[model samples]
Target: MNQTFDVQGMSCGHCERAVTQAVKALDAAARVRVDLATGKVQVETDQPREAVARAIAQEGYQVAAA
Candidate 1:
């Protein structure tokens, strides 16, 4: 499944890497792409939406409503 999240508080490459790492840690095969300027994250994984949201949140970013 593909999920798009409106992530807040991401302003730099480090922030993007943190979000990507957090998601990938949960699903090794998961693919993550972030648009920092737009505060958007696109993830491809089989995991549930809540799980993905939690992972991103754990990285200290807010996941906006879809």
Candidate 2:
């Protein structure tokens, strides 16, 4: 499944990398793409929605909405 999350507090390349790594840590094969300007994360995984949200939040960002 593919999920798109509306994230907040991402302002640079480092922020994007953080989000990507956090998501990948949960699912090694998961594909992550972040849009820093829009604070959005696109992930491909079968994991639960809340799991993904929590992973992103752990990276110090707010998961706005789906």
Candidate 3:
């Protein structure tokens, strides 16, 4: 599944890496693209959207409710 999430608190490369890693932790094969400027996170994964969002949230970022 592909999902786009509105995530805040991302300001640098580290933030992008954090979000990507968080998503990857859930599904090793998942693809994550974080656009800090737009506060958008695009993810392609087999996991559920909730699980992916929770992972990003657990990384200290705010995942806006969709």
Candidate 4:
């Protein structure tokens, strides 16, 4: 499934990496794209939306409710 999340507090490349890593940790094959300027995170994975959101949250970024 493809999911788009509204995230906050991402201000740098490291932040993007962190968010991407967080999602990948849940699914190695998952694809993650982060846009700092818009705080948008686009992910393609088999994982559920909540699970993906949790992973991102665990990385310390706020995942806004969809």
Residue-wise C-alpha lDDT for candidate 2, range 1-66, written one tens digit per residue: 999999999999889888989999999999998988777789999999899999999988889666
Error of 2 at 30 (Å): 0.5
Q: What is candidate 3's lDDT per residue for 16-39, written digit by digit as tens?
A: 999999998899999888888899
lDDT to native, each model: 0.93, 0.90, 0.90, 0.92
On TM-score, the candidate that comes out on top is 1
Q: For residues 1-66, could you state the per-residue lDDT of candidate 4 as single tens digits?
A: 889999999999999999998889899999998889999999999999999999999989889864
List TM-scores for all candidates, in order: 0.95, 0.94, 0.94, 0.94
Clashing pairs in 2: none
- TM-score ranking from best to worst? 1, 4, 3, 2
lDDT of 3: 0.90
Instruction: Give me the candidate number with maximum lDDT.
Output: 1
After superposition, the stretches of candidate 1 with alpha carbons farther than 4 Å from their true spots are none
Q: How much is the lDDT of residue 10 in candidate 1?
A: 98
